[model samples]
Target: MLIKPSTAIRQDYTGLAELCHSIDEPVVLTRNGEADLVVMSYEAYRRAEARVKLQARLIAADRQAGDPTALLDATSVFDRIRARIDDAEA
Candidate 1:
């Protein structure tokens, strides 16, 4: 999908809803040269909105939990995760 500039959208909003419905994500609502608004399907929008809310709650909970699992080093995390998958396969 072409990243639509905000000006063009503002001038031609007649078919915006139809276009938005057909596409997976909302047309990029740009302000100036930068993207500002994301257009997406209603279900996608709801899922995204819910995910953001869930993330905030999760973050607050983690903070309250005093950073549990803080020693998870990324370098070894993949190997650890892969080991779990290997065990599952076996």
Candidate 2:
């Protein structure tokens, strides 16, 4: 989920293994000031990576021909719907 420095990880090798087995989220390892490795439960990692790739594809699709703001700015629509529901009951 969050980036962890390698040194901190190496200090707790057993803990790391247990954490890897226990957690579905990836634990990133930093090396030389950059993210070098990611450790997670094997099956979980595969699934998460696949999802990430799919998300990337979706983002690419959005970038090529869609408005990113449409999904990002729906508060006004939500408020209007809420107001209509309140008025209907009144």
Candidate 3:
């Protein structure tokens, strides 16, 4: 959705909000004929944030996978985490 500055400023917010809720992509709000703010649904924002985080995690994991020193069995990792948690609790 492309919104002109005049329409965005003069129109009621309900229509804009409705469009945001219904659409999957972000609504671009233009000002002075240039790109301005972006409007998107809460769920869309959350999903995008999650995807970015997951991508970062995957990249980190890929880097670690190439480093033999960083490798560890799942059980040892869980045990180490549990020990840390127990130490913190104590």
User: Which lDDT values do the candidates have, in the order given?
Assistant: 0.77, 0.82, 0.82
Question: Model 1 off-target regions past 4 Å?
Answer: 5-18, 30-37, 67-90
Query: Candidate 1: RMSD over Cα atoms?
Result: 10.7
Query: lDDT tens string, model 3, 1-90?
Result: 655463663596787777778877688878788887888888889999999999999999999999999999999999999999999999
Off by more than 4 A, model 2:
49-90
Worst ten in a row by lDDT for model 1: 1-10
Superior by lDDT: candidate 1 or candidate 3 = 3
What are the per-residue Cα lDDT tens digits for candidate 1 across 22-85? 7756677788788887776787688878999999999988886787566567778999999999
- Candidate order (TM-score): 3, 1, 2
lDDT of 1: 0.77
Tens-digit lDDT track for model 2 on 1-90? 867889867699888877777776789999999999987878886897799999999998878657656554478889989999999999
Candidate with best TM-score: 3
How many pairs collide in each candidate, listed in order?
2, 0, 0
What are the RMSD figures for all models against the true structure? 10.7, 10.9, 3.2
